[model samples]
Target: MELTADQDDELRALTTSSEVSAAVGTRARIVLWHAEGRMKKDIAVLAGVSRPTVDLWLGRYAADGAAGLFATKPGGPREQVSADVRSHVLALTRVTPPAETGLSHWSTRTMADYVTRTTGTPISHHWVANLWREHGLKPQKQGTFKLSKDPAFADKVADIVGLYLDPPGSAVVLSLDEKTQIQALDRTQPLLPIEFDRSEQRTHDYVRHGTTNLFAALNVGTGEVVGDCVPSRNGPAFLAFLKKAVAPHAGREIHVVLDNLSTHTTPDVKAWLAANPNVHFHFTPTGSSWLNQIETWFGIITRQAIRRGTFASVQVLVRTIRAYITSWNTDPRPFQWTATADEILAKVRLTQLNIKKLVANNTK
Candidate 1:
């Protein structure tokens, strides 16, 4: 292990410097010891390593200088699974299993079995799981989305977004919607309250009393809600709610943002709208109820009031809902719409393009 002046200096520096790794420093020290005319057995004992390790590093330095000492090679044998097998596995994950396969989604065991049966290659389910994880594929889970196809989508979006960004002078902008079929479900047994070291529990079974429809009007500017519970959600029920809900702000111009439900557009409601000249209705685009702010309020009530509540009857449920609305109005905070029309339209266009490309690929 004859060393150049530079190689000797570098090895000395590595042995003393804190920056170099312990493994590399050990190897450097081993070579330096060999250069000092020490036996491989002596160097191994001094460095707390085996005689073979000392010989290995000394030979590496002799062959490739400092570069050889630091070069790393993969230690294990070649992969048992071929490249074609991995490619076939990945491709299968991205497609639906054939009907005859009797699979809804590809589990590790099912995919491993299918691969071995179809391709005559033996593989384990653990190997399949590891490969899928490495490639960031999750065939068992899915997400959801809705695409709006209304012809007047652009105009409807502009109308709703404008009301949120800028409302008419001396007017109230209200986002109105109905949460229907709220069930009054009483558990068969009493709920167990949370204890010191245990979680709350409830019975799996319940007694269904009945259901009710909640008609809610959210003042976009103030975040205050005018809400009422009705037995049904129809044109007549909606008109009745509107008359009572907006009676307080009678003289002022009212701008209401609502979804494009059939009841909202019926001739009876349209006639009532025409007669009320001061009240204006802005319809959100089809399949885009998220644009209506009242839907946000509905989600809050469902989670906080109805979902976990134990109501013996529909009357109790309605009373509980009214109490939540009253409390909400006490400290109302306006919901802000941040995205501009251009930003929204750009996102929609990109999603549409992606969906079209996917459809085209699937058809081919």
Candidate 2:
């Protein structure tokens, strides 16, 4: 079917509305009904619209086939902040605190004021926002994390990573790390289904089910995870976890890369170390905890498996974690480290040389 100029305009006008809107869907359904040769009342009943509305749409469609459902009102090209002016504003943003603009972090209103002050152009707040976005700029806060410092840390890291990188025959390569004192919280309400006229579900307050220290080791070759929940996450606990991760396999060297916590280098750990020539530990470069493979898996668990979770108790949380591990292990896939041996070695040398330079400076 085809439409007249008036019908084309009517259909084209719908471009302003979203595709999922009832107005658009209604037009589609009506056109489909007309194509099927259904009467106006029957189409109205099926589409949940009034008979008159159906007739109006059908009349429009009869006059103008597919083109009638849309309107072609033109919009003018958007006025934008000039390239020079935007760059100037961005430079100002870096030098001047947002307080001078009467707002924080270069908001649209603030940017508008800044542009006006510098160029005397009465830029609208909305235009200011679009211009900032156009120039690839937005307000964002910086994140923070703890740093590590351990002498001889990098030299031994390779030997630790070797278990995963190139393990001894018939040996399991486990990447071990501890996530400490994880709080088990339960939401008060079940998640509400998304629907019309339904009450939103919410948690009035959270129930603390107690905290558990997660001592986890990832078998990179096998892609299986061995995890334990303990009451504490101290150095002693770490040694115990090492014992558990290493105990199952005999006569094979288990290379593990981890952070240098005080507990990890304790006397008990030293004694354990003496006993197990089969187990080796590697430490990541200071401020580079992100290099640990076990930490990568931990990120997956936090985002995909544990974020916004509600457990009934510590036991329930443990059970859920176990179930998740079981499900994951069913399709155990090995993870390959992409960073080259040379990159690792270079950073190690740089860190060691920097330390030596510091020591020489102190002596002088």
Candidate 3:
């Protein structure tokens, strides 16, 4: 293949320019490579396309020049959905389905059926789905949010986040929490072992063998955990766990990040804090226990060990938990905190503003 200087420059520009579509760029590269005396098979390998496709594009280019390399929209013209019909679909999608329909939310099929019957448009569910996608509407999905009611939410958040991002020198920072009522369950029948093509299975029913509480303290600096399985979750149990957790770090400042639980602030806990002058508590904002790092560890343990375990007794469950903790400490990796307090507060402020706007619109 041979090209004029003008054709070569145009082809090079098409391949290099960011404004050109990827398909166009690829097509241009194929032609340029062919002009450079590369084999059709080599071009096929480099361009990630079949030799047949390379031949087709080369044929198009030879027939129509640079204009032929561009792709024309595929398929016939779409059925024209009128502006009124589009507006109607969008408006209904923004609201809950009518009470008479007995639907809490709208699905593509239900919305399509309703629109077809009401407007006599005979719209297909697929069409309704495509229209919804074009408008960025997803009535099937939902999310959850909660605004903290604590008066000192900002200060508490700043305190905890500061500890995470920059801990005090020579001080121990621990995220402490209790996983309460961990039941020891055993399946009534023996678990069916997994086969080559099947998953392991167990009976849906189980025998409950009592419950225990776990108090875990996650070391922020090293990702190590100090844990205890106690019979109950009370101020006494928490105090005992705290003493055990901080025993190794005696004579150094200890910062414990915990939630605002009643037991956490009980008289016994207050007395223990008063007695231990080096120990300090940094409570997360009310109703924001998710801020505690130990909660993440709890989730990990539940998913990995507790949820599927067939424990014959609470003792077995506790031992399993202890073994898991020991294994974790053998190679502990700290969860890195990236978001700054300012970034978090800014997002919360934006959410609050949006809520206010929604409330005002609803009132109107």
Candidate 4:
């Protein structure tokens, strides 16, 4: 069997491309070997198939050229699922299940059963699951988001992000926040050391020794942290920590980026700002605490130091925190802010538009 130049190239691609399935590639090889003037028995050995299989594919190629190689044998007619049923399944999956069903969300099994009973169409959970995958639906997962209500949100974002991206010469920019109510928890039983096949284990129950609050300031340029474990989180505590945090950068102008908390705007804080003209405070938008870079450091400290430590007392926890900060400062790595203010605003606007459309649809 002789192949046209196009047919030869196409067949070679099917046999060599990683994406082509093994079965299809093997069939392509059989056709190529036949076109190469190889005997059916030799082609069968080379292609790892019976001599009859080679004849079958060669016959197909003879009849329809290269296209016949990819044609699948017909499996007969199947029971067609109505378009209305598919639309109904998708619509149900997108909303919360009815209160009568005692379900907060719809599962594949429950959705299938409900559709079967209501539509009088026999459907399996497997079919419903496939439909969900095709539509990129995942009922098992959830995400959280909050829209900032601060009227000056856009301006505040520009100011903070500007400071992050391009700070003034000889100025120190600090992302400051307080992690409140850090509990010093002690396990009831001793922790079990990890073995060859077992993970390290600790008691599920723990004794709460005491709680402490941590006030932290992250220097954006150097990534060094200035933190203190205070007995309480208040205006006075915050002001004291602020003084300590800025002590090293005494001569330089300081730009402190912080969240909008009640303690942050107290009369005493305002008085301190008035007393020190060099220190400026920039508040993030309300309900948008994530704009501060210090929060990222707080998460890292929690995962590494405090979460699994056995603290007999708050003092022990404090010491542990101090040690961790000291270790972090020795080789600090700064967190880089890459998103531009315009990019952030664009995404926020898109989110707002989507939320508006969602609310309008629900009302209808």
Candidate 5:
């Protein structure tokens, strides 16, 4: 192997630079030596590094060329926990109630305890912190899950979400979902924002006024969201909300994308759908409400308007939410959702294969 001018420059930069460490220099030297047709052990001795390091770097250079050498993470030592243990911890963490480890919901302390007691291998709390940070795992103050018993879950979801991805020739695509709990509370102190003289924060404890439900219908293509606040968001109320959300564009064939909640497909809703053949309802799969565009809008509302605000009552919350919606619509843009159905199905299929392989390996 003969060194190209680019390879020579990179090798010279590695040894003479202030940016990278000696280990990186070792890698660079291996690159230079291997490029000059030198053997791995000979390169190791000349570079004053181990033979395997030279061998590994040479192999990497052969596989990916110069970019692979400097791509190593320049950080502290990685965790000592095995991949199996890390997978086990994540699997357990995803489970709800989390009472097996004796906490209402998972906390860092709870996770640390489970790692120590269940595996019979005591791990440091600092290691627990490092693990969560490394994995982008954290405990939210409030997180919830929905369990649906809808029979027509998958097909309905595919149809509804499909409209957003691949819409009809000339029709509006609306992804609708009900966000049931909108708490109205006047906090002990006002929420503090991070700006100059904006850092004065609020107390978590607040005066409970009431709660409201926001029935949202978002037009994916048009970036239009229309919603209403109601005291409840069950079957009857949802039907009424639907009547309002759909009535504006009556007598036209419009696609309504909704989640697989039992109340969403009640006999009343079925009768309504029958009455309005032009208004078709598409449902997202169970535990797949994230597929809805209105869900994306809801997340923005949570972060921007609701989570930190202190509303005096349900009416106040409604007013604030509506105002925020109006403000958002002023410069509305349709969200660009890029995940393909193939990618999702591939992930599910891969997980299934991994589970099967794990079982087979365990049995063996």
Candidate 6:
């Protein structure tokens, strides 16, 4: 069986190419051997197959070149799950289960059970799971979402995002927040220092040396942080930190973005804001402390300074926190906001719509 030049080159390329499937590569070799005048028995021995397999491929190549090799029929039944059943399962996954179903989210077993019960089709959980994989559906997992119910959500988001993206000329934008109840914990046993092949380890139990609140203000332009450990997260502590935080940028207009904490809206805080007209307060929407950039700074301090520290006393904890803040300000990089107020509002509205649908379905 002599092959055309194009067919010969194609078979050779398929045999050599790394991406060619094992079955296709073996067939190509068999065809090449037949073209080279090797007997079917010899080709089968060289290709690690029975003589009939070599004869089959040689006949296919003689008849249709490379195209004949891929023309084999599928070996199994064409249908397992019917089209209607697949559509029904997909529909069930896309919506919340009714209250009578007693489920907040659908699992593979539960979905299979529900489908079998509703449609009289006995489908296995594994099959349901495989269907989900094929369709990119994950009914078992749920992502957290919060849509602000605050009436001033739009205005607050605008105010904070505006200060981040385009601050007033020559004004300082500061993100302020408090990390409360940071326990000064000492490990029950001394930590095992990291070795050549082992990681550093610490005991699960610890001695509590009391807790402190860390009040911080991050300058958006310079990324410098002004902060101190306080005894409480109350009106007094916040006011004291406010005085220190605003002192550096005294002559310039200072816009502070903070969460809607009770201490931030107290009578004393309001009076202080009134007295200091140059210092303005912009509150983030309720339950949305993630909007405040200072929280990122707090996360850094927690991971680097406090999370793994062995502080025997509250004073040591306070000192360690102060030292970290001072070290951070040496080479601070500011946090920049990428999402606009409009984008945020659009997402919140979409989430709210989805949640409303879920609630309605739950009620039904």
Please give the lDDT score at residue 25 for candidate 6. Answer: 68
Between candidates 4 and 5, name the one with more favorable TM-score.
5
User: Judged by lDDT, which candidate is best?
Assistant: 3
- Tell me the tens digit of each residue's lDDT in model 1 across 1-364: 4554345555666665565476776787788667656788977876778888887888866644444456455575544998767877776666556458976566566788898887778986667766866876655432123457899888888888888898888899999999999999985532222211113211125889999999999999999999999998999999999887788899999999998788988898889889999999898888788789998888678656776578999999999999999899999988888987777777678666655554464455
TM-scores vs. true structure, each candidate: 0.60, 0.52, 0.60, 0.61, 0.64, 0.60
Q: Candidate 6 — number of clashing residue pairs? A: 0
Q: Pick the TM-score winner.
A: 5
Residue range 149-248, candidate 5, lDDT tens digits: 4566545545654686788877777778878778897866311222213132211246888899899888788787888888877899989988888777
How big is the positional error of residue 131 in model 2, measured in Å on the Cα after superposition? 11
Residues 1-364 of candidate 6: C-alpha lDDT, one tens digit per residue: 6554345556766665565475776788788667656788877776789998888888866544454565445565543887767877766676556558876566565688888886677886667766776776654333124456689989998888988999999999989998889999996532221211112211135889999989999999999999999886789889989999999988999999988788888999899989999998898998677789998788778756786578999999999999998899899999777999999888787666665654464455
Task: Decide which is better by lDDT, 2 or 6.
Answer: 6
Task: Give Cα distance to truth, residue 10, candidate 4, Å.
Answer: 51
| Between candidates 5 and 6, the lDDT winner | 6
Point out where model 5 deviates above 4 Å.
1-79, 87-108, 132-157, 190-204, 352-364
Candidate 1 residue-pair clash tally:
0
lDDT of each: 0.75, 0.61, 0.79, 0.78, 0.66, 0.75
- Candidate 6, residue 332: the lDDT equals 91
Please identify model 4 stretches exceeding 4 Å from their true place.
Answer: 1-144, 189-203
Of the pair 1 and 5, which is ahead by lDDT?
1
Instruction: Assess the local accuracy of residue 13 in candidate 3 as a C-alpha lDDT between 0 and 100.
Output: 68
Candidate 2 on 1-364: residue-level lDDT in tens?
3322233333333423343354654575566545445677877766678888887777755543433443324686676666655555555433323344444244444556666865665676556545544555443211112223555545555555555566678766677788886778886532221221223222124889898878888887877887888888787788878888877777776777677778789999988888878777776666656667788777667645564468878887777777877787899766887665567667556545544553454355
Candidate 5, poorest ten consecutive residues by summed lDDT:
194-203
Candidate 3 lDDT over 4-84, as tens digits, reads 444665676676666668677779878977876679998887778999999999997775556567665578667677776
Worst 10 residues of 3 by lDDT: 194-203
Counting clashing residue pairs in each candidate, in order, gives 0, 14, 0, 0, 0, 0
lDDT tens digits, residues 275-356, model 4? 9999999999987887899988997897678865689999999999999999999999889999989998887786676555
